[model samples]
Target: MDDLDRKLNDAFPGYVVRKDLVKQVRGNAAVPSYVLEFLLGQNCATDDEEQIKLGIERVKDILAKHYVQRAEAGAIRSDIKQTGFQRVIDKVSVVLNEKRDAYEATFENLGISRVLVDSDTVKNNRRLLVSGVWCIADLSYSANEAKDESPYLLQKLKPIQMSRFDFEGYAEKRGNFTMDEWIDVLIRSIGLDPSQMGKRAKLFQLTRLVTYCERNYNLIELGPKGTGKSHVYSEFSPHGILISGGEVTPAKLFVNNSTGRIGLVGYWDCVAFDEFAGKNKRPKADIVDIMKNYMANKSFSRGIEQVTAEASMVFVGNTSHDIAYMINFSDLFEDLPTVYHDPAFIDRLHAYIPGWEMDIIRGDMFSSDFGFIVDYLAEALRHTRALDYSELYRDHFELSDTLSTRDKDGIQKTFSGLMKIIFPNKEVTTEEIAEILEFCLEMRKRVKDSLYRIDETFSRVQFAYRPVDGGSWVNVETLEEIDFPGTYHARDLVPLEGESVDEAVIEVAEDHSGTTVQEVSAERVSVPAIEEKTLFEGHKAYRENQRGVSFDGLFGDYLKGARRIEIIDPYIRSFHQCRNLMELLEVALRYFDYKAPSLEVHLVTGPDDYDVAKQRDYLDQIANAMAPLGLDFTYEIDMSGIIHARHLKIDDSWDILLDRGLDIFQKFDSGNAFAIENRMPEMRRVRQFEVTYLKKD
Candidate 1:
């Protein structure tokens, strides 16, 4: 086990299970991850290898014997009949059989119906009465020929979820881990490794959980498929239910008009609608009206009575068009059905997650690390919904007065949920609060901006905020707004061939192979020759996975005509970091004269704490490669241990502060030489970063 694994075990023993263990025992079993993790949490929650092995075998044995498969349902029923009684794992849903004056339990996979269930069982497991819940139930069969009675009988029933959790203890122990550690813990808890995601991308995943941790928060995500949009709601928690968007009915989601019974909103902490973005979907008018009321007022009309519930709503679907096309020709909510495209319904949404920023699911992204058995994490998040951390940013920042009450509510709910998940203890720094506040504003602004494009009556309002401590008001813009400025906001409305909406010029190429050409972004084009280009002084932000960006265009003018350059970035120790430095040097080479007497570039960086020898060797390689090119490259271990500032100093005048330094690009197919991203830097996407050009006074 690594340091994090050891720390997790030491901090909260018997609550966490190795994430990879889920796959080992989940062979062809059509069960949610929480159901499997519940079993694993009971058996293999310890670090002992021998105990884990035994527990794995025991769990596998239990599944093999008890878990029901539709294909083997008949054989299992025969076995139950022969044995007279058997315990099986399957989804169990119950409905009150009014005529019989008893609740009837139906085994979803066992394919049995009309089994008697006591009222107390239905009351204790109310969620099962709403949606089918995975449960381990004892069943018995006694061949009967009666018309109203069946031989199949339900004995003891147990819902496969965390029965009890100590929220106080969980919150107290949460203080033991730093913000970064806790974020990574949540990332791992969701089955993805934190090392594979960036700060922005990690937040993107965490935002999906806000619905679980906040009341009445409505969020939607629409992008290309395979980004795990529905995974969290379906697998990570028992408190959330993921149903098909088309499958939902007003009776199922809100209330049954025939029977005075409540639905999913009354039972689950979060109700996520999967495959929600279809242009042709025909949702019922009553459901849409009920949804708008519930999403906005958190209450729906039920036969002259108003019903209220705390369940947050989440909508996940796939987009047919890319971000640029949607932003230019239509709104971000382009994929929604015509009925749901109502401005009133769209305005009720709190946030629109930029799903395009998330990388598609990859094998290496799955974590094998120790994390909460998900059910435990789910309970903790559910408990946090009762607490409000929205005012945490009031001491440091304030929202724009232009924002409506709905806007404020959306922003506050999102901020509060993120705080509960990240800082459950309610302890945070000002910088941390600012980051969350700005992110909240940007998210809400994304939704509001689309409203302007969708509805002419929606007025444009300034989506900006300022620090209460007296800094300049900061303007917020969605990543798409910055990436496609000319075509976005309905400007220019068109792009001619061989030109770009952002600034990365496209080169025209011919298709000589007698086939259709494939168009790809060329972000990493070679550096242009030095010229009298104006070097602007300001800050710019880039989004993760946003293409058409490179060091050549970012700082080619700043590095031009410099006799001496000092790049002070503390984390240039890894192979990728070193390669990033070499690429930056390549950009500077095109700007500087090779025949110049002293083309000096010294990097102030930190040694790799894990492997300093390897770090030095990589640095040496850069020095050797640069020496032959007439650029004297040297690096020194800052040794200060606090070289947090990443910036480049040119001739003691120009200073370019880098938020992510030279390592701004996201991981890609570096080993695959033929990959377009490897051949063209412009084709590669970048991690969210900021760069500021400042002249030293």
Candidate 2:
């Protein structure tokens, strides 16, 4: 184990199970990951190889003898009859048999029913009434012709869940991990590799868990297929139920008036509808109306009375069109069913997760590292539903007064849910609180901004916030607006009269640290206008997956009219880093005039500790290649080790600070010669980073 893994093991101990072990034990069984992890958590929670091997064998033996497959159900029933009793692992759901005045159990996949269960068992494990529970059950059989009754009997049943979790212990142990480490652990627990995802992408994955923890939190995710949009709701928690969007009815979701029995909302903590988007799929209009009311008020009307439920709503679907197409030709909610296309229904959603930003699930994306046993995490989240951290941000920042009550509520719920997930102890720094607050505000802003385009009556609201300690308001915009300015600022979807939307013009000014800064008007009034050049060099931030960035756009104007340039980046040793330097040189050569004197460039970088000779050779090759282009290149190592800042000094006129130095592009297959990104720097996807332009006056 590496340092983080060892630290996680030391902190979480028995609760941390190797995520890959789930696949090793699940051969052909259709069991969900949580069930398999529960079994593994009991036996193989240690790092000892011998113990893990033994545990694997024991788990295999248990599955072979107990796990009931549908095809083998008949043989298992015969075995039970012959032996008079047998133990099996299957999904067990109980229903009240009014006629017999008893609760009867049904073993799904085992295809057995009418097995009598006691009232205490049903009451203790009430989840059995709605969806079901994976349990280890003992079945007995006895022929009774005189009584005219079936012989199937439920002798004993144990739901496959952690009987008890130490909530205090869990919260206390959270202090041992940094916020990033905890986020990584949570991502791994859900079977994803955190290393493969950006910070925003990881947060998006964790946002799906908010519904599991926050009461009545409504979320919708519509994206391309294979992003694992519905995986968490279906497999991560037992308190949640994932059902087909088309299969839902008012009776199953709200209440059955005939039987007067409460439905899924009464039993489950979260109800998610999979495959929920499609114009052709017909959903009951009445159900949509009731869902909107419940989502807003947390209560649904019953015959002569009103009943409240704490179940959060989730909708996951695949979008048939791309985000740009949807934004230009239609609204983001275009794919939803006609009944759910109402503005009121759309407004109730607290957050809209941009599914298209996620990468498709690849084989390497599954982590083999240690993570919390999902059952433990599930219960931990469920326990946090009662805790509220919505007001935590008020200590540091204040939301704009222009926001409506509904908008404020949506933002608060989202912020509260994220705080519960990341800072359940209610202990956070001001910077940490700001990060989450801005993310929450942006999510709700995405929903509200789209609403304005869809219905012009909905006036635009400034989604800005101010620091309580005193500072200018920090305006937040959806990353979509930054990346796709043309589509986001289309003239047809203009803002309301008397309201001005600030169009951020990103200009690369020559400065010490070439940072991009927005030029805001004194009245805070502007209009949305698309500019050809989007890259700025003064003082601005860029989100991950944002496009329209190139080397020329970032440094072209800054490097102009300069005879000498000094590149001071320490990470210019690796082959990829050298390639980035070479790309920058190419950009410089293209930017400078051939008629001008030779442009001199000097690199002040750290040498490779392991292979200095190879690094020198690469630099020499670059120098040699650029010699014919009227560019003089030379290098010097920083033996002082004090040159930590990554900035470029151009003839004492501008200082450009590069947060990621020259290594901004994400890793790609350089072996593929035909790849366009390999030849064109602008076509490559960049890592999340920031650049600052400081004037050297």
Candidate whose TM-score is highest? 2
Please list the C-alpha lDDT of all candidates, in the order they appear: 0.86, 0.85
How does each model score on TM-score? 0.88, 0.89
Q: List candidate 1 stretches off by more than 4 Å.
A: 467-471, 491-532, 537-548, 561-570, 594-659, 688-697
For candidate 1, lDDT tens digit of each residue in 1-697?
8898889999999999999999999999999999999999999999999999999998999999999999999999899999999999999999888888888888988898898988888889899788788999999888889887779888899999887889889988988898889899999999999999888888889999998889889998988999999999889898898996545888888999899899899999999999998888888887898899899888998899998999999988999988766865677898999898989998999999988778899999999999999999999999888888998988778887888888888899899999999998888998888888888888898898787766766665667778886777787877786776543444123356776754543322222223423332333224557886666888887777678898888888887788999999999999988888989999889999756786899999987889999999999998998898789998899776987989888898898999888998889878887988877888778887899999888
Question: Candidate 2's residue-wise lDDT over 475-535, tens digit each?
Answer: 8888777765445533243334665644333221222124433443322234668766443
> Which lDDT value does model 1 have at 25?
100
Best-matching candidate per lDDT: 1
Candidate 2 weakest ten by summed lDDT? 504-513
